[model samples]
Target: MIVITAPTGNIGRHLLPLLLESAPAHDEEVRVVVRDPARLPGAVRARVEVITGSHGDAGVVDRAFEGADAVFWLVPPDASLNPKDAYCGFTRPAAKALAAHGVGHVVGVSALGRGTPLADRAGLVTASLAMDDLIADTGVAYRALANPSFFENLLEDADSIREKGVFTDAADADRRAPLVAVADIAAVAAGLLLERSWTGRDSVPVLGPQDLSPNDLARIMTEQLGHPVRYERQAPDELYTTLVGYGLNEAFARGVVDMKRAKDEGLDTGVARTADTASRITFEQWCAQTLKPAVLS
Candidate 1:
């Protein structure tokens, strides 16, 4: 049995179809822990066993993990809590449930910066790494997909870009770092869950084909969208204040600021792209295929 958490999310939504189609050939049964079963497509709902509730809930994970062989673990963003509570605290119950249920393999969605000088101070990224540690200690074969920022993040600025020909972030205009497509991350997760051939714990970085700066992204967006586009660098304090104004916990707001600060300072640059680590998606391609449609709409 294979279990998936947050099956209706950006990553999980893409992952479900891949597993449903392929896992059957491997004699695997797919189960999903979700808050709302109706959010699942009708056809998908029929294909998998659904455990209704938050995966962060101990009772939910206890039931979901039972008889499971491998699990795809992705924590949904919960801005109401502090970084530690949102990440590690959410996983603590599930970590125990994994050991108790004897589930052997787990592939979790996490961030980069493990083993770096900045990782310890990178706020949310730090909490994500600690969550990976908590899961690994459960004696499961764990692979934390250490990813950078996502191209999908730009969707948040689609309106801004459409109206003003601009996108915004806290990163310096020239600070280059890897960014990934979430579909690619889902693809990597599905592959690991199906094969389950690897043992022990490690991070599988789904770095996109190359590192791109904010200016690089703006240039690509302009070319792809057939219009002038520009990057707007926002202050970290402004980001924190905005997040807090949205009713996010003060600590969580601080975490968002710290994470952006760390990324701008090269927390994501700790990993070198190799054939094994590099994923096959470029920002330009994403802009044309994904961002263009969103912006044009």
Candidate 2:
């Protein structure tokens, strides 16, 4: 059995069909733990066994993990909640359930910057790494898909990009950082879950093809969307205030500030992508195919 959590989320939505298509060939049973069964597409609901509840619930995960060989884990973000409680608190129950249920393997969505000097101060990244540690301690074969800032994050401000022809962030305008597409992240997770031979704990850095700064992205956006687009670097204080205004609590807002600061300081630049780690989608392709359409829509 292969258990998947957050099956309706950005990555999970893409992951579900890939796993289902391969299930018949591999003879794998797929199970999903979701808060809202209704949110699952009708096609998916008919294909996999569904456990209706949040994965953070011990009962939900324990029931879902029955006879499970591999599990895809992703702790969805809640900006209104405390960072530690949101990440590590939610993970503890699932980790305990994994040990109790004897699930063999787990693929968790986590961030980059595990061993770096800046990791300790990288706010949400720090909390996520700590969550990874708790899961690793459970003795399940674990692989944390350590990703950089997602290209999908741009869609959150698609309205601004379309209306004002501008996007904003706290990072330095010229500091290039890896940005990955969630589709590629899902693909890697599906591949790992399909082949359950791997063992022990490790971090898989799913860096996209190359680094691109926000300025570089704006230039690309201009060409791709056939309109003027610009990158605006907000002051750290301004960014924090803006996030708080968006309903994020102060702690979570501070975490976002710290993460952006770490990126500007080159925290994500340290890891060079290996052949197996590098995702094929480039920022330009993602802009043309994903971001451009999102802006138009």
Candidate 3:
């Protein structure tokens, strides 16, 4: 049996069908922990066992993990809360349940920056890595999907790009870094959850096809959307204030700034992509397929 958390989320929504498609062949049972079972599609609700509650709740996770062999774990972002409390706090209960239930494999969505020189200073990344440590300490077989900035993040700026032909960020406009498509992330997670041969704890870096700077991204967006889009680099302080304006707590806002600064300082450049780690989607392909439609809508 495999238990999945955040079944209605971006990755989890895509992951559910993939897992279900493969489950019958493998003779696996699939279950999910959701805050609202109503948010799940009728097909999904009909197929998997649904436990209605946040997975962060100890009781919810404990009940969901019963008779489960593997699990897909992801802490859905809550910017208004403290980063540490949101990430590590959310994982602790699941960790306990994993050990208690003897669930052998756990695939978690985590960020990339583990061995970088400034990892300790990278706020959000640091918290995510710490969460991985907490889960690994349970001695369950763990694979933390160490992803870089997501290509899907670009969609958040789609409206701004459509209206003003500009997007802003704290990172330097010329700094190139890895970016992965969330679909590819889901694909990797689904594959890992389906197979039980691997053991022990490890990090799987799901880097995109190649590195691209914000300027490169803007150029691609311009071509894809048939408009001249520009990249604006905001000062770290300005970015922090803007994030606070969006209702994030001061500490979490600062973490967002720190994460961008770390990326500007080459935090994501430390890892080279291997055939197994490199995802198939390119920035251009994602822009054409995902971002362009979002902008038009």
Candidate number of the best lDDT: 1
For 13-97, candidate 1 gives per-residue lDDT tens digits of 9999999999879999999999999999999999999999999999999999999999999988689999999999999999999
Estimate every model's Cα lDDT from 0 to 1.
Answer: 0.94, 0.91, 0.90
What candidate 1 gets wrong by more than 4 Å, as runs, is none
Ranking by lDDT: 1, 2, 3
Clashes of 3: 0
Per-residue error for 274 in candidate 3, Å, reads: 1.9
What is candidate 2's lDDT per residue for 1-297, written digit by digit as tens? 999999999999999999999999999989999888999989889999999998888888889888889999999978878889889999888898889889899999999998999999988998899999999999999999999999999998799999999998888888888899999999999999998789998999999988899899999999999999999988999988888999898999999899888878888888997898799888889999999999999
lDDT of 3 by residue, 136-222 (tens): 999989999999999888778888998999998888888888998988999999999998789999999999999999999999989
The stretch of ten residues in a row with the least summed lDDT in candidate 3 is 77-86
Q: State the weakest 10-residue window (summed lDDT) of model 2.
A: 77-86
C-alpha TM-score for every candidate: 0.98, 0.98, 0.98
Give residue 250's error in model 3 in angstroms: 0.8
Off by over 4 Å in 3: none
